[model samples]
Target: MLLPMSTAIAQRISLENHLSLETLRSGAGGEHHFNGMCQAACIASLLCEAGYGTAREGLFGEAERVLLDCRRAGIETENWRFDGKSYRILAEVLTLHDKQLSITPVRELIRANERLKTS
Candidate 1:
């Protein structure tokens, strides 16, 4: 059986992983990754608008950083691709929240990318 703390950690990791996936998607060209990252950022922004303090700080903050990082890396929004390790790291960070909003769409975006790869 998993301890409560361990379970929480696991959840936190999952969230970060998803967020990283969002970042990768944002970078993948012809793959809708950037759009997906933007969508996730919007979701996080909405949470901030709703006054979820931690969510606003953590999620939205991370989203902003991801955007900035992409820019710094010279990764254009129009030509981005998923980086699996980065996705896992971001998902870990995202999992720290107790709430479960804005994650599903991100997951969908990842799935969509997977589909594209297979097709």
Candidate 2:
């Protein structure tokens, strides 16, 4: 993944694996770490919804995704639903999980959540 000059270079290093993909492609992998975090978060949120809590632990992007999911689920349990933010999160998460890339920015999900007071 290409680490932009604006993002911390430290994010390129995997603290767990101790490997760096930073050296790939002249220090450009044609991807960004934030996108990876979004993909990872989507997967983690799905797994959590599937009753796998362990998947979310320690992942960089899982917290907010989980929070969003929790809010969505809470509304569903209350027999109410959001027309915009809920489906947007669901579609984006599924799209990212399937394609590993999304045209939608994950931050948009956060924004929608904030706008709706869902988180």
Candidate 3:
């Protein structure tokens, strides 16, 4: 029988199995591993480099809210492509919430995504 997991245990599991930038870049697990998940990928990279607090500071909540709002507004949060808007919005949110975060990587990722879209 499958039992429900406690929040603490679930959190630990999530922390341990974070998706990395390399994974996003290589798509080793799948070609679409990063499809429509740019927001999550960004947060995971930050958490991997910094710590859980980087996400706890506010990014997760803000990201969730953005997704929810998009859904409510009947916007299809692309499930087959990189979400550039999410990355851009997340970069801004990071600036507001965590001053110590290095967003250069995020900016670079955004540029890379843009190039992929154009090419």
Candidate 4:
């Protein structure tokens, strides 16, 4: 059950769970144009951090990859909208890695590092 979360929350979670907003906001593949690109952006971030050049090179390409991988992983993507898919993709990525980080430190890091930029 991937619930739609606020964009603010999604941004924080991305920074905490994976990469920075700068990475997700990349102009690759014209991904920022779509409304359902959050999940793709998160996937792009993950793949980029994992040293995948193609993922770092584009967003929608990564978006397509996410959808495909999700299907292969027995997950669905039709329900994602707005910022909803961000959490869904992030959860899947976490599960793939068998890793977890407390929300507390992430929040603190956001407050200390990212909040000022947004504010």
Candidate 5:
């Protein structure tokens, strides 16, 4: 599977530039599983941003840690089911688990959650 620059390097790449496919996927090999597991991919990207690791190794290991982090941060995750489509799960986890994150990746999710309260 082909992959573009990571969430980290993506900031530097010009969206207007016509990057070659080879350049985009130059270093890709076994670390391209984002399409099937959006949550995992987001978590992996977050972990990398948090100084965990670059390569997406040990999916189960990363998942275990993410769950633990959620629990430690008092985020209720027992009822959470990963359908691999909703990135909101990832956003919620990150938002609640660590309020220190710079990027608000789930602004829409936040608004939706708020709307549910006033409705």
Candidate 6:
């Protein structure tokens, strides 16, 4: 499916400004990392809901990795889920950021989530 031009451009900009591992590691903290992971899972879940299996798989893989990192750092993340499926937030974030997939739906999903939160 073709994404909106503005969304595509925004994705490109995000890719250009992608975060580095060093930056992520340096800023790693309990709440920040957890939030990042949640963001990743939300993105992946959106892509999966939109029928983008390949993108979903990639994002899910990344989320798993991030969760592993959380575990290594002695942070607990045992309750996150997507449609009854358990997920690690950090790994999801990595998967959601994969360059091979477009993140337009992910952005929309996030916005929807925000609306839901406020409503």
Using TM-score, give the best candidate's number.
6
Candidate 2 lDDT score at position 104? 23
- Candidate 4 segments whose C-alpha is farther than 4 A from its true place: 1-64, 67-91, 96-98, 107-119
Return the top candidate by lDDT.
1
lDDT of each: 0.47, 0.35, 0.41, 0.37, 0.35, 0.46
lDDT tens digits by residue: candidate 2, 1-119 = 22212223223322211111121112222224223433445544543443334332344253465435544554456322223443344334443333322222344434433544442
- CA RMSD, predictions in order: 10.3, 16.7, 14.9, 13.4, 16.9, 7.9
Off by over 4 Å in 3: 1-35, 38-56, 75-88, 92-119
Tell me the lDDT of model 1 at 36: 47
Enumerate clash totals for all models, in the order shown.
Answer: 26, 0, 0, 0, 0, 9
Q: Which ten residues in a row have the lowest lDDT in candidate 3?
A: 20-29
- Residue-by-residue lDDT tens digits, candidate 6, 11-73: 663453234222344443344444554454555455556654455346565555655555455
**In candidate 5, which residue pairs get closer than 3 Å at backbone N, Cα or C atoms, i.e. clash?**
none
Q: Look at candidate 4 and give me any clashing residue pairs.
A: none
lDDT (Cα, tens digit) per residue for candidate 4, span 1-119: 12234457655654543432222333222222232234434433443354332322444444556545433333243322223364344444444322222222333333333433453
Measured by C-alpha RMSD in angstroms, how accurate is candidate 5? 16.9
Residues 4-116 of candidate 3 have per-residue lDDT tens digits of: 23446544534422342234223242333333344443444444344333434565556666545443333343322214564455445444323322322444434444654
* Backbone clashes counted, model 6: 9
Candidate 6 yields a Cα-based lDDT of 0.46
**Could you give the candidate ranking by lDDT, starting with the highest?**
1, 6, 3, 4, 2, 5
lDDT, candidate 3, residue 78? 34
lDDT at residue 80 of model 2 (Cα atoms):
23
lDDT of 5 by residue, 41-80 (tens): 3444454455444443554355555444433333343332
Q: If both were scored by TM-score, which would come out higher, candidate 1 or candidate 2?
A: 1
